[model samples]
Every structure is written in C-alpha cells, then in structure tokens.
Target: MKTLHFALPFVLIAVGCDMSPDYKQPELPVPSEWNTADDAERDSSHISAIGWKEFFTSPELQAVIDAALDNNRDLRIAVLNVEAARALYRIEKADQLLQIDAAANSSHQHLTEAEGAGPDGRTANHYQANLASTAFELDLFGRVHNESEAALETFFATEAARDAAQVTLIAETVNAYLQWLVDRETLDLLQRSLASREKSLELVTARQEIGLSSKLDLASAQAAVESVKVSRAIYSRFVEEDRNALALLIGKHDESLLPAEASLENTTILEDLPIALPSNVLLKRPDVREAEHQLKSANANIGAARAAFFPRITLTGSVGFASNDLGDLFTTEAAGAWSFIPQISIPIFDNGRNAANLDYSEVRKNIAVARYEKAIQNGFREVNNSLAARRLIREQLDAQRRLASAREEAYTLAHARYEAGLDSLLESLIAQDDMLAAQQAEIDALRQELSNTVTLYKVLGGGVLR
Candidate 1:
C-alpha cells in the first residue's frame, strides 16, 4: 500500500492537466463626466439591445434594412469570419484536456542474416495494438490558458464587428432612401417649371406677332423656356440613376427597386433640437466596442508571450491492449499496455527570440488600447457634431422658408406687372428664376434637416439597433 501510494502521485501528475490562466479585465480610462443636454438624460443601459424594428420604426425603411442584412455580401463575410474565430477557440479549449489516440501494428521479418533481437530476444512475427499520444504539451506555465483567452476575445471582437456591420447597413439604407426622395422632389419641381415656362414662351410669341412685344423680347422668353427644359432633362437622368444606386445598396439583384422615399415621416424636423448625453454614449457604439474587444485579444497575447519564458511541462502517454494475434487483440487475457512520460523544457535561452516576442506582444497590446481609445473619441466627435448639425439645420430651414415666401410674392408681383404692361420681359424672367431657386432651396433645406436627424440617430448608437 505504501509503494502504491508513492506511485499514485506520478500517475495523477501524468494523467491530468490544469491549464487555466489568471484572467482579469484590463484597465483603461473611463469617463467620470458625461455630455448631457436638457432634452435628454444619458440612458446607458444597453440602448442597443432593441431590435432594429423599434429603432427605425418605418416599415419601408425596416424592410430595406432586413433585405440588406439578409443579402448584403459584406455582412455574410463577417459571419464567415465569426465562424473562423469560433473554430480557433474550440482548438484552444481542446488544449486544456488530455488527448487520446489509437494505433495498430504488425510485422513479419525475414532476417537479413537470420539473426535479430525481438522484445523477447528472439526473431519472430509480432503484432501489437496501442492507443497513445504522439505529443501533448502540459500547460503548467499558462501558455494554453492565455492562448484560449486570446481566442475568446477574438470571437467577441468578431461579434462586435457583426454589430457594427448591422449599424452601417441601416445607416446606408436610410441615407439612400433620403437621397432618392430628394431627387424625386427636385425632378418633379423641374418638370412643372418647364411646362410653365413653355406656356409663357407661347404667350410672348403671340404678343410679339400682334405688335405687343418686340422680336427680341419673344426670343428672350423662348430662350428661358428652352434653358429650363434642358435642366429638366438633366435632373430626370440623375433621379433615375440614383434610384438604381439605392436598389443596389439594398441588395437588389432583380430589376425591382426599393420604395424610395423621404425620411420626413421617419424623423422630426425639430422646432426644438433633441440632444443626448455624450459621456458614456461612445462605449455603446459597435465600432468602439469592436475596437475594445480587439484590444482585449491583444492583451491576452501578451500573457501568452510572457508565459513563454517559463518552463513547459508535457505528459505524453499511451494505454492500450496488446496481442500477438488479431483474434486476441481485445481478449480479456490480452492485458493492456501503458506508458507515461512527463517532460519539462525550459527556454534556457532563445538568442532573444522569446524576449522579443514578449516585447512585441506588449507593444501590440498597447497599440490596440490606443486604437480603442481613439475610436471612443471619434464616436464622441460624431455624436457632438450630429447634435450641432441638427440644431443649425433647424435654423437654416426656418430662414429658407422665409426666403421662399418672399420670393413667391415677388414672382406673383412680377408676373402681374408684365401682364399689365408695367414690367419688361427680362424682369419677369428674372423673377421667375429667383422664385424657382428659392423654392428649390427650401426643399433642400428641409431635406438637410431630415438628414441631420438621421445622423443624430446613428451617432446616438442608432435607437435600439446600436
């Protein structure tokens, strides 16, 4: 019993592996202050947890996003990347456990000189079967543990990347829809304006023939009508081409196009701007989260590299039944054969290779941390800029409305005077042009305002889609 007791220690050490490493979340700067506005309190409790449906709210826009998520090639590629990372993590997890293997062998030797030493000191036919490991590293120095952590972090990073892709997809879809709406409205206005100008040209021609105006006056009116028609043709082409672009972004492979529209219903043109707290908002951004997860993976690499300087202990072992005949391979009397080899290797020296690895890992981790911090700062910048834009655009829209109203009155007055013979052909034409410009500008300003609100939604980590 005493002898057995002494042998059990060796068996236990040989048969078991404990490779878990000490892990802790790395330290980095966190904001003690937040950017808050009266319009909102910083609600930081996983605002991103909401489904995209709740965030976007528009059935048309949501449909576009759903289609893109399903068909977008970039999103599919990110999913593939996550799969690859998961496979790597599985490999790392397997490293923490002992592995078993099996093998079989048979030999019949016709001695070259009729003389050879077998296991029993005689030339003979031999057969054997065994289950054994070729090599297994004992992770006593935490190398395997750190490697596993690195793999886990990489998996998490991929998850965050997927979320970031989702955010980008939603943003692009909304922007494309807004662009389509802007183009359509502009095109519609141009078409109507062209028709009105043509009627004016006809009137001027008739009046010149009746001696109510000179030929020069008629020519000027006709020229204005032609110029507007030319502009209409250009705008029509632009509208059609942009609609096609939106369809592509929504992952359309067929001729079918998206229900392109204005985001006006989807967002508010605020009489008062909505503002959010900026302090912890950056952390919720998928891009920032992705960057931080990458930093964690890099930090895990440092632990792995640091562990390389220590001794590596490995246990290579095999246990299997043996027999001289195939029929007896698993027979009760075919007693099992077994072996255990516990090995320890120290990197006494590596001509600076191991040390360099350690330095490189640490430096890389530092770089990753810096990158994560930079991403956070950039996120804050986007949020703040979006807020400022929303505020300024609201003011612009108001001013543009006033200008449009004034130009509208001027147009009516000019046309009246021309009909009453108080204004020249040139004056009426100029006033018509000014009115069109003001009206177009008003539409542009409203479009800009809606766009700013969407930007705010995105910069705020995008409603629940975060």
Candidate 2:
C-alpha cells in the first residue's frame, strides 16, 4: 500500500503534461492614433466607461433609456442568453470533478442441481449498498480543462454580446427621441409658413381684382399656400411615426410616459466624448471584446482537439457492504465489498478521424482570428467615419442656420415692400419660398447632427445602464 501510494503520485505527475497549446492573442493591424482634428488631444480614458445616466443630461431622455433597458425584448433575450451560457460553462467545468452516487440493489436467483447449488433447485437472495463513482476521465492532456476553458470563454462572449445589445438599444432610443423633437420643430415652422402663405394669397387675389396684380401672380401665391400645406402634412406624419418608434423601443406603448413635445433647442446631450487611441476601441467596444473571447474559445478548442490524439485515462471506484440477508447488509457481519477500475485508451488506429479533428480545429482557430481582426478593423472605420462627420457637421449646421436667418430677413423686407406697392408680388412669393426651404434645411441639418452624435456614442461603446 505504501509503494502503491508512492507510485500514484508519479503516475499523476507523468500525465500532467498539457497537450493544449498556449493561447497567444492575435496581433491586430490597428493604427496608434485616430485621424481626428489636430487640436483634439488623445484621451486615455475611453468615454465608453461613462454611465448612461451621466452621459445623457436630459431627465426625459434618461428616463426613456431606463425604460428601454427594463422592457426591451431584444435586450431581455440577450440577458437570457448570457445566463444560459453561464449555466453551460458550469456544466462543462463540473466534468473535471468526481461524480459520486449512492446505490442500493437486491437480487433473487434460482439455482438448479446441475449448477451445484444443491441436489434440488434452491433459491438465493442477495442485498447490497454502496457509494460509487462512475467512469471519470482524468485530465492528463488537458482535454477536459480546455473544454471547460472554451465554455468559460463562450460565457464571456455572451456577456459581451449582451452589452453590445444594450449599447444599440440606448443609441436607438436617444436617436428616436431626438428625431421626434426635430420633426415637431419642422411641423411648427410649416404651420406658421402655411398661415403666412394663406395671407399672401388673399392679398394677391385682392390686388388682382383691383388690377394691381396679374392672374399669374395670384396663381403663384395660391401654389405657395398649397405647397406649405403639403409640407405640414408630411412633417406631422413624421412626428407620429417617430412617436411609434420610440414606444416600440421602450417595449411598451405607454403614451403618458413618452416624452412630451420637447424642443430640440432645450435638449442637451454630451457634446464631446473622450477620444481614446484607435487600439483602445477594441477594449472599449463590446463587439470587439466579444470577438476576442470567441477567438480565445477557438484557441481552447484546438487544445481539446490536440489532447484527443493522446491516451485517455479514466477511473471508476466503489466501496460497499454485501450480505445474503437484507438486515445484515449494514452490519459488521456483512461481507465488505469494493471495486477499483483504471482504464487507459491508447489511440492505435482510426480512419483518420483524429487528424481530421485537429485540422478542423486549426481552421476554426484561423476563422476566429480573422473575425477578431475584422472586428477591430470595423470598429476603427466606424470611429473614423464618425470623427470625420463630427468635424464637418458642425460647420454645415452653422452655415445652414446663418442662411436661414438671412432668408428670413430677406422675406420680411420683400413682403413689406410688396404691401407698400414698392415691389412685385412675384418677388415676395419667391422670397417666402426660399425662406421656408432654408428653414427646413436648417432643421434637417440639426437632425443629422443629432443622429451623428448618437452614432458616435454607440460606436465608441457608450456605457450601458447598470
């Protein structure tokens, strides 16, 4: 027994060599810095770490995102997926430990005289009880360990996916709310334009009757009124549609909880997000993190596959009491029974299945590596595109606002001149048309800028609600 005990340690030590390859993170082809404005300083602290509540200043907007986090169906599914993956990982990890069970059995048998039980047929009864461990494979080459590691990585990947879903939900909710505000603003402008155009048509018709304006000028005035009416109807529809989208994102159609007619001018989200290094995006973005976890999982799979080519060892054991009488089964008079089995399976010959598995694992790892790199590349592209838009959109929005102001002034002056008999009705109508278009353009630009801001937030892995 002493020698047996001494030799068991050596056996375990000999089989402790891991066949699983070491995990080396795949090198990414990422730039050191982003192509941002020269004045923009690099921020080591990624903006993604900011909480959603802290990033969004509007109480109404924050409430909307909170509702979505609680009620969004897709986000709920993502959370459930993480739970399932965690459970699967636990199951896989449990395989590396012993599994013991308590067992009890009774048997009856008839022995014939030819079986040498007795001259005549006799009945025999037996009873036994024991604790036994079923066949448990020893992780000599780390097959079980690698498999567990893969499962753990898979769990981590699902968690990252959940975070990615959360980011999307927040971005969508904020964008929809902001868009609703823009549509409301445009609708108000169109209504005011419609009223002005109606008054102009009345003035032009009165002048035509008095021989001060031509029928053509009157017709132009009428067309402008009808055009503003059409624009009003379109924008009103946009407002309603935007409301419906927001309701869906929040996972309920509670109109009372939805944001009331809030003006875009009053709405304020964070204007500047910290700009981290391009490579940091991989760590900040959940999708990129998810891809890295998948790569690690594939790497672990290769280890498991490699281990499959080596000999597998398993052990089964039981210790029990046995007796012909059921009452005596647990007594000292009962016979002590025990069993121990150590199994070894050395791969002799197979139809190239093991080699094929190894090949498949290698290819899968390659696919994972490619995917990981692609994720980084995609993240970099999104951040760069958003940065480019961020730099140019502010300029565009400012120019549009200035043009709208100029057009408004021109329309006011032209209208007063037409009423004072110093200008033609055609001139006033043209100025009014230009002003309406310019105002609408300004609103559109504002909406684009707001949408771009949400995109930047999402691409930068803006924080999820805790």
For this target, which candidate reaches the highest lDDT against the unseen true structure?
Answer: 2
For model 1, what is the alpha-carbon lDDT of residue 304? 81
lDDT of 1 at 14: 39
Supply the TM-score for candidate 1: 0.87
Candidate 2 lDDT, 112-200, residue by residue in tens: 99988878889999999999998999888899999999999999999999999999999999888888888888899988888878888
Model 1, residue 132: distance off in Å is: 2.2
The 10-residue segment of model 1 with minimum total lDDT is 267-276
lDDT of 2 at 21: 72
Against the correct fold, how does model 2 do in TM-score?
0.93
The models' CA-based lDDT, in order, is 0.74, 0.87
Question: Residue 7's C-alpha lDDT in candidate 1?
Answer: 94
The alpha-carbon lDDT assigned to residue 75 of candidate 1 equals 81
Off by over 4 Å in 1: 1-36, 39-46, 111-124, 253-257, 260-276, 463-466
Note each model's CA RMSD in angstroms.
4.5, 2.4
Q: Candidates' TM-scores?
A: 0.87, 0.93
Q: Supply candidate 2's per-residue lDDT for 374.
A: 92
